[model samples]
Target: MPTAVQALCANFPDLTPPATLALRLEALMPSRRLPAGRVLFAQGQSPSAFYLVEDGEIEARFAALDGRMSVLEHVRAPRLFGLAAFISGKPSRYEAAAVSDSRVRVIGAPAYRVLMDDWPGFARALMREFAERFEGNLRLLEAARHLSAAERFGVALRQLADERAGPSDAEGWQALRATQAELAQLAHLSRQTVNQLLRAAQAEGRLRLRYGGLDIRR
Candidate 1:
């Protein structure tokens, strides 16, 4: 293994003494970046790789027959996306897009299976990531089921707040890159409804938008 690859894999229990991180990565995964609003992959496309976010955000979205995209999941920094169809041998059921300029790790199927064969814990870790994403999606779905549009928006903020510890006093720079229209889809409401909710939240000091990004305060 190259020195850097060894260093990178030192903390990873599944890592092998491969040629290099870059070489093993060619087998394991490669990094990817996509522009804002561009689809990384579409529903029913070949599932080639599993993705883990290194930076920025990705929304796992689906477009209706009416041509509107609904967000099923929001993947933030240091999280994973693009694993569903990758593991299941199905075409992607949704589209993934950068909510902003983003970076992600793309693990090819061949290399991933190799890792799975050698590292039980690594395999379990991937499965665990999928479970977490699934449950998080369910929580949003449930919130939309019971909450009013405005309240659903509140719920989204609360969820994000919980993720970033908005309820705690650990405030810092954060970005909610979702546009109101996008938030509408996630909240299962109209853009106007989302705007109204956002306005309300802003008035109450729970959210504040800077020039390019929105910040949520608990």
Candidate 2:
């Protein structure tokens, strides 16, 4: 448990100093791994652990009524996830799957509870993580709710713009790993509609679909 802190100090972007960071991290987290396409957790599954990405990437995918996979978001190394269910004692809202080979820290409910009581700094970190997830989830819901298809398409571009503009020094843009079909499900439209929208955006210089993924200039 104690050594866990050192790993966090090295792994986390927001890590503080060594000893204190180590003390803050140790015992509060547990590490695990999953292969590509492996399900780390599933929607409607009971929450037993919260996850923090240490390496590799994960996709937060929601299953549609028609049994389609809609990727809500991608979580990369150093990002945090799975905590929302832990905190709420509810089933997962999305199925978390490894996008590639991955490693993560699982903060069990008991350990998280203990740390929140005994370690102020670690508690703050945990709370901050939870807050981030809450806000992001809220934003996603709000954008999707009460919107027509065209409005949803507009929201998607705005989201792409925001994601692509994030700190290059922090990490390169979030991988545009989403397929056109996934975008269609997310936007509640057909794949052909998504392609048309993408082309329109591209022609307007709002975005460019590169080999790896789509690029948003704005």
Candidate 3:
């Protein structure tokens, strides 16, 4: 099995640094295990560290005034979370929790700053990550503004498949580990609408529903 440093390098290929620098980074970041449903950080909490998910899933959620929580993002392994708040020196905008039992590498604010100041490659990689996420958010907003319910559902399904689906089978079908309700939330549609869309897609040979998920044709 690869060490944490190796996994980090694999996830962020642009973060190339000298051997000594990589060693220093490994020393600065520590790994932690979180049980499923455990909250990593809550909304409005001060940012102390950013997390690199090494295994399992994390959910970024927003709580409404009515005491309801909505998932804003699903961050799978090999992704970084909490960096925006940490870098901006602001309180967290959403709560982060482990969707499943998870392992993560914690990079404290001081260590992040030291690397950003000393390692040009690391800084560039982080900037690129931020830019990519920003562009994605803009596209999502555009979709929501102009796309129909079915079109929005299609886009959401495709995005989720691309991000977190299992390997494609010989028939070009990939397993997506998400329920109809979760898909509805991601598509910003009602559950009934999502169900109708799923049935339509299935009838068209685009996807098939499973017990807890769906197999989508790529």
Candidate 4:
């Protein structure tokens, strides 16, 4: 079996750490398998461990009134989660859960700091990833401020379709495997508005509302 460092290196080939940092990571990181829908951490929880997704998807979300959820991010393999709290020395900003059965490497804050100190590449990679997330959040904030609900829904569907499309399926119809409520939360809209938007799109042949999700077509 691969050591923790080796597994991390394999997952993130471009962000290879030096020998000393690798040793430290191996000592500090432990792998865990999470079943689908497992809650990794919750909002307001004290920060202890950050995670690297070895396989599958993790969702970071905020719980709202009436039990609704607003998605913060969807993290895939080779990506890190819970870093915002780790860096800020605050409680977790959002709850994290396994979106599918997933393997994750749990790294404590101390080890993460060591890696950041000793591995320039690793630090750079983390910075880049976090920066992208920040930019995405900023865009979402801007969209919520200025865009109509319909426009936000359209943008959300197009983006989700692109992310799910395979190379062969590119330029063809695409499916979004999220419920209407989930899509509404992600797009910062209400379910009623989401339904209206979907109905309009379906009428125009731009998309079809399915039992669980949406099928978007060009």
Tens digits of per-residue lDDT for model 2 on 25-56? Answer: 55557678799999988999977887767778
- Estimate the overall C-alpha local distance difference test score of candidate 4: 0.76
Clashes of each: 0, 2, 0, 0
Question: Model 3, which residues run further than 4 Å from truth?
Answer: 117-120, 142-146
lDDT per residue, candidate 1, 101-138, as tens digits? 98776767666765677544666666765776578677
Question: What's the residue-level lDDT of 146 in candidate 1?
Answer: 85
Stretch of 10 with least lDDT, candidate 1: 1-10
Residue 83 in candidate 2, Cα distance off native in Å:
1.4
TM-score of each: 0.72, 0.73, 0.87, 0.75
- Model 2 clashes, total count: 2
Model 2 spans > 4 angstroms off: 1-28, 64-66, 110-122, 157-178
Ranking by TM-score: 3, 4, 2, 1
Number of the top-ranking candidate, with TM-score as the measure: 3
What's model 2's overall lDDT? Answer: 0.67
Q: lDDT score, residue 93, model 1?
A: 81
**Per-residue accuracy of model 4 over 1-218 as CA lDDT, tens digit each:** 46777766765578666766666777788888999999998888976888888888898898877877788767776667788787778888689999899988888977877877877777777778678767777666667778888778765665455444333356576766766775676688989988888898889988767887766665
Per-candidate Cα lDDT values, in order, are 0.67, 0.67, 0.81, 0.76
Over 4 Å off in model 1, which ranges?
1-23, 162-178, 205-210, 213-218
Residue pairs clashing, model 3? none
Which ranking of candidates, highest lDDT first? 3, 4, 2, 1
